[model samples]
Every structure is written in C-alpha cells, then in structure tokens.
Target: MLDDFMTRATLAGVGTALAAAPLGCFVVWRRMAYFGDATAHAAILGVALSLAFSMPIFVGAMIVALVMAAAVTLLTGRGYAMDTLLGVMAHSALAFGLVAVSFLSGVRIDLMAYLFGDILSVSHVDLAVIWGGALLVVALVAWRWSALLTATLNPDLARAAGIDPRREQLVLTLALAVVVAVAIKVVGVLLITAMLIIPAATARPFARTPEAMAAFAVVLAMVAAWIGLQTSYQFDTPTGPTIVCVVAVMFAVSSIASTLRRAG
Candidate 1:
C-alpha cells in the first residue's frame, strides 16, 4: 500500500505536472520563458505579503504574480526590452522578498521552503487548492485555445481575424499567474520556471503538431514526477529539485537522440 502522505504527494505532483504541461507549451511557443521566471520570482514577494497579512499564500502569490505580469505587459514595446525588463523585475522581486521576509521577525516561516520547495509536506488542503487551480487553468486555456494561438502567431493577424490579441495575451498572462501561484508549494519560486519549460522543451522534438507536443509534454511531465518521487524517496533527495533533474535528464536524452538522427 502506498503511504498516505506519499499518495497525496503523488496526486499533488501529477496535478502540478498536468497543469504545467499545456501552459509550458504555450510558454515555449510564445518564447515567454523569462516571463515565467519573473512571475515566479514575484511569488516570493507574495509569500512575504501572505505572512504579513495572515492570509493564504495562494491568494498573495496570485495577486503579486498578476501584478508583475501586468506591469511587464504594460511596459512591453514601450521603449523597454522584454529580457531586460523581466530580469529587473525578477531579481528585484526576489531581493525585496528576501528583505521583507527578514523584517518579519514577528512571524515564523521557513524561507527555504518557499525558495526551493516542500512538496513532500503537502497536505489534503494543499491538494484541493492545487487541483482546483490546475483545473481552472486547463479550462481557461482550452476555452481560449484558438484565439491564443492566433494572437501568438501575430497580433496583427489576430486583430484582422476579429480576435482581440490583447485580450488573448491577457488570458495567457492570467493563466501564467495561476501557474506561478499554485506551483509554489510543489517546486517553490526558484524551480517553478523549470517545471514550466523543461517538459515542453523535451517533448518538442517528438511532436509533429501542436496538440501532439502538448500531449507528449503532459506524458513526459507525469513520468518525470513519478520517477522523480521514487528517486527522491530512495536517495533522500530534495523532491522538487529531483523532479526537475529528472525532466532535465529527459531533455538531454531527447536532444542527443535528435542530434544523432539528424547526423545519420
């Protein structure tokens, strides 16, 4: 029999993987990997705010992540480069969050858990939040799929097709924020972006279509979660980083295979 806690952890891991896969594909498609980093970094600030306010971390992270994303969206193409802007926001938010957490001597929270992860410590309540948030994101993405794809291809083309590209962009931004907030418990702030990128990237070579890529990403992410959990359990390793390591190894293998195939 699976240990009860391990069972919850597995469910949580699989839920997070399902959420990350489709959204990660969009992140890869739109070249918004840096944006994921920035939003996730802002999650640290959310942690500070949640501690200060005595509210749920999910609410705090979601608010701050959305703000960070919106701030970037507004600043984009307005005489500022995306990479520079995201880098500034990402590091600044992280630094500020660290500083803020330090000032909160009145409360006690483990900073390392927020920075790295504490997936093994997840509870039933956390599972509810994780699954709820993940399903919401999946539904929202599915609803906006066509328009989002069109807008991602070309804002002008989307506009010409009577689709508001800005709206679609907002939809994606909102979804990304949700991912940032909910994923904090699973991979924490530092590794969230990796969970968002690596699986989709690993699946890229085997995919012949967009849908196929997403399916492959989901499968690969789930497999990584299972393997990562087992390896971490056996080795007494960090669950979150171990999962990312598994995904990274898969990516390496896929890259090598693709290279050899091309060479042949």
Candidate 2:
C-alpha cells in the first residue's frame, strides 16, 4: 500500500515536472515573470469561484487565467505601463479572492493549500488532467517553436520576416495561461512563479541555443522535482515549497559554477 501511494505520487510529480519544464523555458525567454505572477495571483479567484459554483478547480483556474491573460494583453496593448497594470490586476484579484473565499461559511478551506499546493493529495484524475493539458501545451509550443523563438529574440525582426508579433504574443499568452492553470495544482499560486523561473535560470549557463536552453531547463526542473519530493517525504515538509527551495538551491549552485568556470 505504501509503495503504491509512492508510485502514484512519483508519477504525478513527473507529470508536473514535464509540463513545467517547457513552459518555464518560455517564461524565462520572454521575461514574463510578472505576467506569470499575475496569472498565478488570479488563480486564487479561480479557486474561490470553483468552490462557489461546485466546479472543478482546474476548469475554474483555466477560465480565470485565460480571462486575466486576455485582459492584460488588451490593457497593455493600449499603452498602459505593463508593470503597473499587472501589479494592480494581480493584487486586486488576490484580494478579491480572499474576500470571496471568506463568504463561504460551512466548509473549511485552507487558503494555504491553494496558495502553496497539496501535491501529495493529488488524485489519479488530477494526474490525467495535468498530463493531458501538458501534452496539448507541448504540441502547440513545438509546432510554433521557431516563430516563437524568432519573436522572442527580436520582435522587430520577426515582424519584418512576416511574422505578426501581436499574434505570436497572443499565442504565447494562451500558452502561459494553460501553464499557470496546471502549475497552480502542482506548486500553487505563490510558488508557481519560482518553479517557472528558477529551473530555467539554472539551465541558462549550459545552453548555447534557445532549444538547448529549453531542454536543459526541463532536465533541471525534473531533477529538482525528484530531489524535492524525496526531501519532502523524508523531512515531512510541504511538498510545493520544498520543491521551490530545491530549485533555488539548484539555481545558486549553477550560478556559482558558472562564475567559477568563467574565472578558470
């Protein structure tokens, strides 16, 4: 019985790491850390709405994240300072979600669970949802990898090359929304950004190309997931935060190694 549970948990963790890996690469490439934070913050509202409407958490999060992404795109397209607008929207959504959750009287909802995730509690159905969503995201990203990279490297150049930057931005936004929704279940809203950023950052030193960077990022994220899970299980700590901490450690080690290599 214990072995069975461990197997299931490991499977779920692998699914999460796989999904996060590619998305994390894009998040780093485009410097979308704030955008990711915005989407993650909006996830709280999704959770609140899911409880209020008796819907699946994933469905609610995806819907809310897509809406938030669209709103950010539209607002920023109209000349708003990206940072200011994102900050307002992110904090406002989080505040509103807390207020919304407070209105529910009977059920005891631990906000921390949604904020930091409960990965060990993930069910088989959740794994299916994570893997299925991940596959879709991966397919879309793979198909548009070249165009996306072109845009990321030089938006003006991509535009000159007949690629529409706006359209590509929208595509990336949608991808990010899916990533945010799925990642919330793995690492929750507060820590989700760390998972996306840290692993990719750790992989940067070893990458000579965008594709290589992405591949390395995936490997780093998976390693962090495995190490983090083992640490969590052994130390009886929260799984999500432990994963973030592991990723952080990886980042620090990578940075130091890079510096040393440069000196040598």
Which candidate gets the maximum TM-score versus the true structure? Answer: 1
For model 1, where is the 10-residue window of minimal lDDT?
A: 1-10
Question: Which TM-score value belongs to model 1?
Answer: 0.97
lDDT (0 to 1) per candidate = 0.92, 0.85
What's every prediction's RMSD, in angstroms? 1.3, 1.7
Residues 83-124, model 2: lDDT tens digits: 999999999999998899999877679898899987887777
Error of 1 at 260 (Å): 1.7
Q: Can you tell me which runs of candidate 2 are displaced by over 4 Å?
A: 1-3, 77-79
Give each model a TM-score.
0.97, 0.95
Candidate 1, residues 46-131: lDDT per residue as tens digits? 99999999989999999999999999988889888889999999999999999999999779888888988888998888888999
* Clashing residue pair totals per candidate (backbone < 3 A): 0, 0
